[model samples]
Target: MNDLRSWRVPLPQTAVKCAATVVLAALAVLSTGDPQLVFLAGIAALGAGALALRDLLAPVRLTADAEGLTVVSGYAGKRRVPWPDVTAVRVDERQRLLMRTRLLEIETRDDLHLLSTFDLGEDVRDVEAELLRLSARD
Candidate 1:
């Protein structure tokens, strides 16, 4: 295998959001003093903490080698697709009113894998170009 290239999903902002959620939940429990409110806040704090821990522990990683690509998604586990199995690589764009987003889709013989811009940490066009170059070598 050629030198393995890896990209880490950006999560500093997400970590901040998670921490804020937990803090707010704690404050709600302390100020409200309502059993129901406390319970709800506890649940929210747990959920947010779990998400934060998941991101910290099993952070999303995208790796490419001479053979193919590997995606390690937190909680969702990992997936590996060889270049021979990849039939097409394209960018899928979605627009919702004024908001627009792009995703990289890798079409294999039997499945389609979607990669978010956040996970790629680079432009989809550049990733596509690299994938094409690596695939062409084989």
Candidate 2:
């Protein structure tokens, strides 16, 4: 088996955003005595804190080797698909709002796995090429 190669979702930016949200929520609660504003701030803080903790605890990771592919998604935990189980690997593009995003779709005999570009940390095409190369060796 070859060495396992791993890719992780980029979270520094998200960490910063979460921190900013918490700070802003704190400031809002401190600056105003209004109960309504304070309640809203508290809710914001809770949501932001939850997101931060989730990102810290369960980061998305993708690992591949001679054997197969492993995906560790936040909240979803981990899933492993062996090479023989993978029926196809392709790049999928979707438009959300005004932005277009690319993702890697791995189709197994009984299931499908979608990996975001953020999680793959590389061009979907490159990941697809690697998948093809690894699958060919089987």
Candidate 3:
């Protein structure tokens, strides 16, 4: 990552989960002809599919560069954070369901963004280290 001017990390596993949600919801709609079930499933499929579509279409969950970090926001928009605004970058780990979960925490002047392995498709520690390096260069 040293020579790279920018890094765009994709959420492949999260996209797969979203796609699975859509498929499962659609199956539920088909299996049960109930109007309520159909309506609920339709909502689920559309909502989940639309979000995942943004990732699948652009294939980017997060982006980092010399200037700042960019992350997916809204339906198809991006939120940018300048390097100066970033206050801290760290990896947080916790126990969940008999396993450990790790996430990268990006603290800005006014906000805190936590990204999981599913969201980054990379180990949080590695991402944090890379981010720290970039910030140091800044």
Candidate 4:
């Protein structure tokens, strides 16, 4: 039997990018004189920035089951890998989870998401341990 566990990745880059976009947009608004153009740009930039932030702040969920592992990155996309196909699991120097499989490379970059800005951290070890346990079962 394979036990299951879940993990989320830390996000810092996302937040920083979102903040920079917002700040730049604000600056643009201040520098522009046309009310119509300024309003339109401001709305567009702010809206896009907010959406980007939402994506960054969203969770990157990792769920492991008997057959394989499923990684759902908010609305970005999802990755499912069978245990038997996984070739290696390692933590990179950047602290990202590097998962290599027969067909894919799953790089979980903790700093690329925005959750870390809020001091949120994920337990990659738990996910790695579950993957190990499942791989052994097979």
lDDT of 1 by residue, 1-138 (tens): 576777655777567758867796876669675877777777778777776665666565567788888866436577898888878888898899999888888888887777776766788778877777777754
**Residue ranges of candidate 4 with Cα displaced over 4 Å:** 9-21, 33-58, 72-75, 94-120
**TM-score pick, better of 2 and 4:** 2
lDDT of each: 0.74, 0.76, 0.72, 0.55
Give the Å error, residue 90, model 3. Answer: 0.9
* lDDT tens digits by residue: candidate 3, 16-102: 758777686867668675877777777777777775766666556567876788866655567899889989898889998899988
Clashes of each: 0, 0, 0, 2
Candidate 2 lDDT over residue span 43-87, tens digit each: 778777776665566565678888998876446478888988888
lDDT tens digits, residue span 1-138, model 4: 657665553456456657777876886668687777777767777776866665565555556677877765456566677765555654322433684322122433331222221222444444444566766743
Model 1 lDDT-worst window of ten: 53-62
Ranking by lDDT: 2, 1, 3, 4
| Candidate 4 or 1, higher TM-score | 1
